[model samples]
Each structure stands twice: as C-alpha cells, then as structure tokens.
Target: MLRFLFDTIFMVKVAYNDAPQPWQLGFQDGGSPSFEGIVELHDQIMFYLVIILLGVGWMLGSTIRKFSVHHNQIVHKYHNHGTLIELIWTITPALVLIAIAFPSFKLLYLLDEVIDPVITVKAIGNQWFWTYEYSDYVNDTGETIEFDSYMIPETELEPGQLRLLEVDNRIILPVDTHIRFIVTARDVIHSFAVPSLGLKLDALPGRLNQTSVIINREGVFYGMCSELCGILHGFMPIVIESVSLESYLLWLSSQNSPPYSPLQKPHQFPKLGNPWGGIGTPSRGKRFYSTSSSSIDFATSSNEEPLPPLHPWFVTGLSDGESSFIISINQRGNGWTVRCSYELWLHTSDLSLLHRLQSFFQVGSVNLRKSRPMASFTVAAIDDLFSVIVPHFTNYPLQTQKRSDFLLWAKVVELVHSGSHRTESGLLEIVSLASAINRGVSDKLQTAFPNFTPYKRSLIEPCLSGLSPNWICGFTDGEGCFDIKITARGSGSYHQVECRFRLTQHIRDKVLLELFISFFGCGKVYIRSNNKAGDYTINNIPDATNILVPFFDKNPLHSSKLLDYLDFKQVVELVKSKQHLNPEGLSLIRTLKASMNNGRRAKD
Candidate 1:
C-alpha cells in the first residue's frame, strides 16, 4: 500500500505542474520578480524552519527510544508547562514574523510608487480593439500617427503561434524602455494587462487610469482581455513586440502599408424565399428609396422661402435667392431719439441711374399717435435737391447730406434698419449695407476674379528695384483695372485723373498689377474709393518721379496719352525716387511683381 501511494503521489505531481516553475522561483536577468530585496530574511526563515523540523524529529526519536528501553508503558505523561520555556517559544515565533513583515511592507510601498516615465502612450479601448497613440515624439511638422490593433483569428495564425495569442498588428516597443500608458474607453469598460510585465490597468469609460511598464525582453509577448465584455469579448487579444530602437523605427515605417488577409467563406444571410424571410429585394429597395426621398423632401421644405432678384449678398456669391437679410428693432428704456443710416457702393459708374434708383425712398415726418408717414418725398432726385422721404419721421431727425456723404452714411442707415429703426435711451442702432456689400463682394471677387492686379503688383517691386540702372521699370502685361490716387505736395496742384484699364484677361490683370506694384516698391496697396465718384486712390504712392506721374521721355515706346492714363505708375516711381515708400509699400510691390511671373502660364 505504501509503494502504491508513493507512485500515485509522484504521478500527481507530474500531471499537475501548476506550481511555481524553476524560472519563476527566482528573479532572472531578464524577468521581473515579485520582490527584489530581503533575500537574507527569506534565507534565514528557511534555515530556521529546517532546523526546527530536524529538532522535532530528533526529540520524537528520543521519546521512542526511551519507550523501547523501558520495554512497557503504553502512555507517557509530562509535568505542567514552564513559564520560561513557553515565553521563549512564543517570542521566537513573533521575532520570525516581525522579520518577514518589515520587508513585505517596504515591497508594498515600492509597488505603489510610480516613477517618472520617459514616454507616455494613450490607449483608447474600443468594442473589441485597442487604439494606441504616442503622446510624445511628434514629427517635425507636428503630426502624429495613431493605429489600431485587432486580433488575428486562429486559422490565420502561423505554425508555432499560440491559439488566441495573435493580433493583426502587435504593439511595438523598444526594449528596456520605461513607458507610461494611460488607458480609457469610449463605450464599455475594458482592461489592459500584460502578464509577463506584471502590469494590469482597468479602462473605465469616460475615465483615465495610468500604469507603467519597463520591457526587459526583446521578443513577442501575448495577453488577452481580462474583463468579460460582450459576446465577442473572448476574441480580443493583445500582442506586444519588443525590439531594438532601430528595428522598432523600421517596423513603424513598414506599417504604413496595408495589412494582408487570408481568404474566407462568403458571409451567409437569411434566405428571402422563405415565408419568415428577414429582408427581401423589394423590401431593401423600398427602404433605400424611401430614405432617399424623405431626405430630399426634408431638404426642400427646410429651405422653403420666397426667392428675390438680388438676394442677400454673401461673401462668395448671392445668398440662395432668398431674403438673406434679417431686421430686429426694440426700445430699451424711456423716450429716446433714434437715428438710422444705411450705406452701399455701386461698382458701376452711373450716378444718374443711382439717383433714379434713389427715388424709391421718400422723406417724411411722423406724429406720436400715427403709425403711417405724415410727410414724405415722392421723388428722391428732384433737380439739384436730392431728397429721401420717410413715411413716419416725426420724432426722427430730417438728416440729409451730399451724395458722397450719403454713400458713406448709407452704411449706418443699413445698421439702423437692421436694428428695426427704434432707438431707446443710451442705445444707437445702425444698419450697414456697406459691411454686407464688402463681405459679399470680397467673396465673389476672390472666386470670380481669382487674381487681383493690385495684389500682384505688390509682390514684384523689390526684385526689380534691386536690379542695376535707376531706370523706371514698369509694364502693362495686358488691360487690367486698378484703383489709383495721385497726390501732389509742396504747392504743386496735381490734376486728379481717373482712368479705368480694361485687362484683356484675368491672367494679364494679375500679371500687370503685380509688375506695377513691385516696381513701385509698395508692400500692401489699398484700393480706396474716397467717398467720391470715379476717383479711387492707390494708398501707397511711389516717390521717384519728378512730377507725380510716370515720365514718357524715358521710353521711346511710352505713349504720352498712355502715360496720362497710367498716371498711377508715375506717382509710384516719383515716390520710389524720393525714398518715401515705407516697408509695407515695398513689400506690396515685391509681392505683386512676383505673382505676375509666378502665376500659371496664359492659356494659348
């Protein structure tokens, strides 16, 4: 029976080898251990346990010997326990336990201590996959590439691969590098754990948890989902690959390519021919068409509004033919006078047409009790007296001014109109048609025009000035429209000339504008219409010319009439010669000139 029991025990130990293995018994060079210190304490405890066991065996043998020597006596009795002996036994065990507890406490504290890590990686947990982002080590351009790692099915695993241990792309690391991982989830809770590293962290939704790991080995390691998530939870696996820094970088670059996959059987769905069919061809078609038709109807109804001829002008184009402007008026406090103004700029050079158009509004006075106009103008343009009639203007001031001031003040009118015309105490309401027009025109001009002559002229002047010879360098690549202003100083009365150049093509317009601006050495040239009809100014006038205009005597091909038409260029040269052009003006010139030559080639 003893022999049989011994054999059975040996086989049991061999069959169930679940206890600590040889490699796990002590810390290896590359493996992390549960404890690092108190080696001597553990050794002393083991020695004492052995000695005590031997002493107990010897005492029991002596007792047996004594019984044999006596040859009789079935029982043996001992006197009451002595206090000294009892005290010695109890104190010795207490000392042993105290020795064990000291190191154990220290180890616990050490485990809780989180050292500063060299790198931080944010891991976002998804349904059945993990996304990893390196918060540090961004590229020179400040772009970071994040990627997802998903499990590789069993059938796709290689020969020696462990089941449920493979991932499509393994998390990579540099060996012996300390990395801090911050884990969080977007939906359900998940856990990030790697057994070999002895690290585990819970990823709670909407919460962040951090843990650190220092990889010691340069090989592939595997882990699985520790939490029981939904149905496909068991399928999620994590694989980590540690390599040298060079190898890791190489692997990272190679990962830019798409991943490879193996062929699989076609997915099967419920048969539509059956009575209990899930979805049929007709049903799917109807669902798709219904969704599309509903979307169209919703869009149409949402945008339903009356279309107007010139809808609210948006920056880029006209607002979708609908009344894009909105007006709101409210009184704040007690009785207060209100002044409203509106302003708009007409691109066309037709003042009479504008005057005729102004006939739409009439001036009038209003009584406190009346809701309608008391007095108003039937015609806005009545000879030299241009007037505006308001149906109800009793409490309001009868504000009138010249056409120029009117244009400028019209912006304020628009603001007042937008404010609903009612002004309360301490509040001034203004409606600016000019603001809207500027925004709308800017957007449309950028798209329809694409290239601006003024902007281009601003680009090229510096390079031309840097060239040899003080000769005036300017060119009109093609017919282009520009706003120019000429001002004479030192008692010289300069002729205020207004000329409109028609650039043959938009490309030529851009080129000529750039060349002109660049030669003048102006950085940013503003095209300002100074509240006057037909007269616009190029804010940065060149200082090089003797007269405030370009000289035709310098160039044989230069036409005096053309020079007069292009007086803006002469002014720029005059300013340049006098060194009156500021840095901004110079920059504008450089930009304009460069743009002309740098733009796309003209379409032949």
Candidate 2:
C-alpha cells in the first residue's frame, strides 16, 4: 500500500503538468516568477474588463427599455444637450485604463530589466536546430561545454516523449537560480520561446538578445521556434530540463570530462540516466553528439568491443601537425638495429581520442609518459607500420611540410620491411633517410655514420589547388593560432589593438603556407631568415573581421584553441564597436588576452 501510494504520488507530480494539454484555454502552469507575474497582470486586466463589460451591457439594456416609443409614448427633445452621461462614459474608461496601464507598464519593465546572473548560457539558433554553450564553466583543458539540440524524429521517439517537441539533447539548468540566456541566430531569424516560463525572444542574426529567467521548480519544459524562419523551422524544438543544483553540477562535470588515460586509475563517473536526459551509462555503449551532426562515438566494454573510428581526413590533418615518423637506430650487440615508428602525442586529457585513432587504423597502442601530462599512440611493428600506418597516410595524404618527412620515413619503412637493415650499405641508407625526419637520426648514429651523406629530400607537390575545410579545421586545431596583440601607438598614451590569425610551419612547408594566401584570399606569408620558419599572418582589421572570422565561425577548431578563438572573436567585436578606445574596454581586452594560450595553461 505504501509503494502503491508512492507510485501514485510520483505519477501525479509529473503528469504532463509542465506541457500543453488538449483543448486547453489557458496557459500552462507557470514555472517561473516572471510567468506568474505575467499571469497576475493578465488577471488584473481581465478583472477590469469583466466589470466594464457588465456595466456597458446593463446601461445599454436600461436605455433601450426605458426610452422605447411603446413604453414612453413620447420622444425626448434636447437629449443631445446632456453632458453628464457623456462625461461619465468617457471618465469611467479613462479611470479604468489608468488602473490597467500602471500594472502593464510595471510588468513590461520587469520583463526587460536584466539582473546579474550567476550562469550565462549562449543560445545560437541555426536553420533548424539550437546550439547552446555554457560560457561560465571551463573544463580541465580550458574548453567550454557546448552542444546542439535537434528534435527527435517521430519514429525515434520513446513512449513518453512528445512528437515534434522531443529533442535528442535538452538544455539543463539549476532550479531557482537566476540564469541569463544570450541568444542569436547563425543563419536566419528565429525565436527562442518557452510558453510555460513566459520566455519569448527573437534570435536575430548578427544581434544578441538577452533575457533572464529563474526556474521555480524542476521538470522538463518544451518550446519551439516561434518565428517563421524556414520550412524546417517547425522541426526545431527546445527542451529544458530543470533539475536540482546538485544534478546540474553533475551533468556539467560529465560534459567536460577528459578522455580516459591509462596511467591513472579509472575515475568513477556519476550516471545520470538516459543519454538524452543525463550523461548516459557509458557501459551501455552510448554515443555522444558533437555540436555538428556527426556524433563523437564513445563506448566502454570489458569484452574487447571495437571502439569507433575517426574520419580519415581528420586523421591526416592531425597527423600533419602532431604525428612524427621516425627511424631510430639502436645498438644490438656490436651492430645496429634500425627500426621505424609513427607516433602522435597529445595531452593526457585526449587519451580517449588517441584510443579512437588506434581503433580507426586498426593498429597502434596508447601509452603514457611517466614524466609529463602526455600520452602517445605508437605504431612500431614493421608489418603494422607498412600495412596500416603507411597506407592510411598515403590514401589521405598530408598537406603540410610534414608530407616531405612522411615521404622520407616511408622510404625507411620500405627498406626495413625488405630486411635491408641487415646489410651495412642498406643500414647506412636508412640512417641517412632517418636523418632527414624528425629529431634526425640520434647523435650516436650520426657519430657512427659520420661519412654517410644525408638523404636528398624532394619538395612535396600538393595535388589539390585548394584546401579542404575539414582538413583546414583539423590542421588549425594543431598548428593554427588565434592571437590578440595590444601595443602602444607612437609615444602617446593611446594603444593599438590587433587580432591575428596565424599558421606557422617550418620553411620546408613555405609553399604550403603560401597557399593559405589564396585559400583565405588574405594574409601574407613571412619566412624567418634565421630560423627557417614560415608564418602566415592576417593583420588587416577588415580581413580578420570579414574573411578569417566568418571562416572560423563556420568551421570551428576542436581543441583548447577554441577558447582562444572565442576570445579572439570577442576582441574583434569589441574593436568593431570601438570599445577598445575606452579604458574599461581596453582593460577587459587585456584581461582576455592575458587569459589565453599560455596564460590559460598557467591558470590550469
């Protein structure tokens, strides 16, 4: 009996109370104080309306009944001269309007006034979906949590989920907390409106509209795009899961977790329930969605289930920046055993990504360094190097100067596979080729083979006339930089601020760096004479604001660099608004600049 009563109570507590009901005449239950106030103002106006309606109806009826020709048998002469009735009718409405206007204005201003909120969520409307970002929180790697919410198709909807309203990801917020939503649209105009909370705001492109709300209770509320943006606009839905403060924090933590590392003991993660509702059970092989349509697949298993593979283009782009192809000569007895290996290193936080790469190529092992916060994926077996690593890169092709090094390394791999390392001449040739790759042949090998000539490396001729957006995005995540520079102009008190988008590579990749000029239709390539390094930089304000900003806004970086990009973009906006001329705005820009890149790492 107790269990039955508890179940009944739970059912009643959640029974579609937060959603629309069939043939309902009134609004859904208000879950916010603002909505409650709106309701009160509505009722106040309705009360005055009822009184005016009754009074007018009674007066009309009395006038018709008393002045009828059949009853009075006479027509009133000089009735138009009566000023008392006219005065009463006009004055009564004026007094009623005055009473209504006060509360109406009060509620209007209350809705417009914005309080300082503890949490700020950025909601960006796209064609048919919503993108949300929590700007206040940063994970261990200095990355903010962001995700896209898409409506679940009717075919995929579960038992209790609402059609056209159920979304794959719901925006979670803490109940009773003052939260600010900064809304804007990416492509076209859309509206972010939740009827239950009385939240309705237009998400205009290129303009940010902000509103504050304090959820009064915990439950799931649904909303849709109220604007007629496009045909699919009806498909976009908004889901808000207001939960307790503790549950919200748990969800936040789960979103920004670093990829698992082998060096550390497995950390226990709190399970929140369904993947769409909470951080899904990792053991159940749930897939996490990125801001894009492509999902970042993650699964846990004890029976050796195959992990998801990464895109080949992404692999090539990352390898062009982070992977090293090396030929190392180690002493075995009195002779040398030259071995070839391909390696990529990442911060320990990205160990899971490396694991995915391993699963992608069907080779390599992930290992951790004992001395640093780093992990590596290495392919050292001769067969694996020749069959998997070599073939993958050959098919995808590296675009940077790394391609030159890869070519050299591939030669050494072939030599080792052919057992040429067993002969003196072949070993000398292998070492010479290795000498041209990363960290060149070790000092001992160079000292031993002092007379061997270094391999002649041919310049890599890129096949394509342009850069791929995905490849560029991935490569930027590794070698690209979004920087802000502030320096004094002349000897005056004024300062000059500049936003820089740069890609630097070794001189061998100067041709590749030059390609960026045509690729972006801006930016100049400068080669450092002393260091043989090439820098592709865009310093023109117009170019940075127009070309570079929009490009990156469309194809975003995926690493911690994203934080820097966001800051850079913010600085660009400040500069655009001429805010940097003021002391406060300059100081804010300086703070942002200082908190980026190395400053961000220092804070970490």
Candidate 3:
C-alpha cells in the first residue's frame, strides 16, 4: 500500500509542467495569473477522483466482509431498490457533477476574457523557425522594430542555457503587465504553446489569432511547438524571459546591435487612395516621420478662419484628425537627441486654419516647404509643448481613438519633462513607453532598443459627451464613411448610380450610429444582415449632395478617404446633372466611379 501511494505521488510529479521539477506531482505551477486557476481546477478534479476511489473501495470491501454467505442464516427477499438509496445514488452524483462544474466554468471564462494589453507582440510560426515582432513602436523617421528569434544550435548553447530550448534571441516580456500575442503562420499550421503561461494557440495561415498573458513572476519559461511542423519541429523552442518593467526597458535599449544614426530617415509614404478600402499611413507619418520646424508654412489663405482663435476643444478635435504627436530620435550636431513633437498638416488651402491653430495654441510655428503644396503647423520646442499644448488638452481632452495615444504621449512628455531622457534608466523607460503608442511600436525602435519593453496600452474609449462639428470630423477621420454604389437591374440594364453615405458598426455599438443622426441632422440607422450589423445610412441624393458634400468639402478629409471622397463627390455631381441619362454621360460617371471605393467590382 505504501509503495502504491509512493508510485501515485510519482505520477503526480510527472504531471507537473512548471519546469519538470524533481519529485514533481501534477502540473507545473502556472507562470501566469490565469494558469494558476487552471492548476487549481486540475487539483480540485484530482481531489474528487481520490474521494470517489476511496469511498467506493471502502463500501465494496465492507459489504463483502459483513454480508458473507458463511455468516448469513437467511437470505433477504429478491432485491428491490430502496427509495433512499436511489435518491442518494442519483442526486449524489449530480451534486458531485455540480461541484466539479462551477470552478471548471469559471476557469474557462477567465481564460477567454482578453484584457486590454499594453504591448502587442506578433509571432509568426514557420516550417522550421519563428519570427517575432515589435512593429507598432515606430520611430520619428517612419521606422519600426522587428527581428527574428531563431533557435540556438546545440553546439552554440551557453553553459547554463537549456540545450534545445535556448534561442539566439529570447522573447522578453514585462512582469505584471498584460501582453497580447498575435499569432499566425507563414506556411503550414503550427501551435505556439507556452505551458507555463497556460497559453497554447494555433498559428493558422492568413488567420490572426490572439491570446493574452500576464506573468506574475519573472523567470525564463520554456515552450515548444506542440504541433507536427516538419523536420525542424524539435528545433523550434520558445524561450520567454520575463522581467520587471524597468529591467525589461533597460534590456530593450541594449538591442541596437548597430545603433541608428540620426541621419538615417525612412521614406515618405503615398497619400490615401481609398479610405473605405484601407487606411494607408496615418495622414502622413504623424506617428513616426518628423518635419523640420523651419519648413512649416505659416502663410494662412485669405479665406482662412481668422483668429479669436479656434476653441481649444475645436483644436483638440481637429488635431485628432489632422495632427500627429511624434516621439522622435533626432540628430543635433554630432549627437543624437530624443524629443517629442506635435504637427498639424494641411493642404496649402487650409494654411489659414493652421495659422489659426498656431495663434490659438501660441506655441507652434507654421511653414510651407518651398515646392510642396502642403503647409504645416509644428511645435518641436520642448518648453512650449509642456506649457501651452499639454495644458490645453488637459482642460478639454481629445475625444477619439487617438486619446489613448495622447495619454501615452503625455507620459513620454512627463519623462522628457523631468529630464529622464538624459539618464540611462530614464531613456530606457521612454523607449518602453514609445514602443506602445499609436498603431504600435515599429521595427525601428526594436533595433534601437535591445531591451525595449512595451508598457500597458492606453485604453481608447470614445468620447462619452455630446458631439460637435470638429469632434465629428476627428471621429470620422477614424471611423466615418462615404460610399457610392452603381447597380444593374434584374434585366441586366444599368440603373441610376446610387450614392450613399454610411457608417457601419457591430450590433452592440448601435448607439454610435444613433448619435450620427443627431450630428448630421439627417440619415437613419438601418439594421443590415439579419441584425448582425448596424449602418447609419443616407441614400437620398439631395441630402448627400446638398448636406454631406458641403460639410466635407469645407472641412475636408485629411486621410486617404479624401481621395475616395473627391471621387464620390464627382459621381454625386454627375448623377445630379442627369449625367446618367445618356451613354456618354453614363460612361463618364462609370469611369469616375470605377476609381472609387472597393474598386470597379464593388461599385457595380
């Protein structure tokens, strides 16, 4: 019996995964918060297993011993089920099932709830290797941070490194912060499993699957590809090195194998072709690229909004659309300097608006590059940023998706404000915060900061208050839509080109669609696709031509959508002119519509 018990204990030890510990029992202690719950549920189930075994074992033994044929003088009548016994047998098992169910459901729920992650790390599993990225963290030059983590060869492993688990580059993470892994595959299917962290997600080709983890303790946790991923299946091992936020930041800063010289700049991206199709770069490198303060064109157009100054809220709203807050590593003399700057870009036509903001903010400079058609309002001066720009937003905050970034930017500013950038440690902290802002850290920052850590992401909650014109512009910059569709009759003849303005949302966010009705003073919310989607739509030609056209034309879209809007506006004008009446007119409208959203196919 003692030997049996000892063997059972050994079995339990074999099951623990934490690190395949000596004399281990059951599962390895979970490396993350949710994993602990998983371990607890496993233990709870085992406890029930032991109880069922012992209770049944004792009952059988006792019945056999007490009711022996040798001791029985008379046998009981043919067996009939006792009501009490039946009740105990049926309800007792049900109770036991209930006991097992509650925590099991809770553990499953805990695993499914993906909390807002501060840093989003993308992992792509390949046939024989893995590539990890920190792309969201971009630089002032429109650069991003990305690198591949290949498994270390056995012969190259360090003395203390686990032979097969060691990697040329380790996955570094922060302790006590949420991390979301966007896992995908380049070719065959693979699973990125980290047993210690209780994370096992299949990496499917062209499909992005997400799983979040928060490590409670800092240590090196090893994982492997559980799926059969060809000849190198064993070679691809995962080594996650978790550390405190500060240590992780310091480590990240050390990654620039060959540090970036400030002279190297990323190329400029093209303008948005179709806003409805895809968002190109955020309205001209506001996140990463930097424009010189001297190049800003302060020349306001004759028709520009004159100063009593644009209201701070209006400025905040427009900035959410037209502006970018950039954290940049710049060249000053022979040395590199890290600074935070704000820019508001406009076509030469909106120079007066830029000038208006410049006067209102009273900090930034305005300029136009000699040959460029665009004018800029820029505030690169550190003192003015903290004194004027920061305080204004603090009073009347930005109410768009960009608000989260603004908060993170403020953190960077505070760090810069306190002269933290001058110190080695402070610079590292700034690098960590910098990687998490905007669309996410880019590959450039990763190369610059070896130990770059991504802090908790800013929570991007929409404005809860009433909407204003400028606020609507900023919100639309991120989510609004304008569309034109041309359909054929059942008989295959061309019908009138239908023009509509729309904003779509998941059924859960119907209120935002309702809010649009109040903002536009026109349009109605229509439930599309079996109540799965809600669209705020205006299909009326006059309303779109008269109301929507003038508003956007005056205010103007600052994104790739501007291209689509211009195309859409042309189609609306042609349709209003009865251009669809004749073949030549119809052909012109068709030609213009072809270049519009989702291209020719979607329009038809």
Candidates in order: C-alpha RMSD to true structure = 27.9, 27.4, 26.4
User: Model 3, residue 349: what's the lDDT?
Assistant: 43
For model 2 the TM-score comes to 0.47
Better of 2 and 3 by TM-score: 2
lDDT digits (tens) for residues 50-76 of candidate 3: 999999999999888777887775667
TM-scores for every candidate against the unseen true structure:
0.33, 0.47, 0.40
Tens digits of per-residue lDDT, candidate 1, 1-604, equal 7756987878643232111234676622222232223344456667778877888789889877877747756554575578998998789889867876776687656545545555567887778888887655442112344677877787788986667667776788766555678889877988886666555678899999987666654766666677777777777777777786446544543432211111111122122222112222222211111101111121123444422221111100101100012222222223232333222222111112122223322221110111221111112111112223222111121111122233333434443445543543112223222223222223432443333232101122123332211112112211123334333455643323222232221221233334444544443333334522221123433332432234333431111123223443533553455423454554444433333221211210
Instruction: State the lDDT of candidate 2 residue by residue for 1-604, as single tens digits.
Output: 7756987878744444677677989989888888889999999999999998898899899999998997898788866676897898789889999999999999989888666565788999988899999876642224467788999999998998898999988999977666789999999999999988889999999999999887877989999999999999899999999997556654654563322332222233333332113222332111111111112211232224554456678788878888888777887435787767888987654555677777788766665554576667777778889988889888888997688899999988999999998999999888888888767767788789888888777778664453687688777877888888899876857889999988888887887888888888889998887868989999868898899889989976655577788999999999988899999999999999999877876665
After TM-score superposition, the amount by which residue 90's alpha carbon in candidate 2 deviates from its true location, in angstroms, is: 99
lDDT sort, best first = 2, 3, 1
How does residue 365 of candidate 3 score in lDDT?
Answer: 63
lDDT for every model? Answer: 0.40, 0.77, 0.69
At residue 228, candidate 3 shows an lDDT of 92
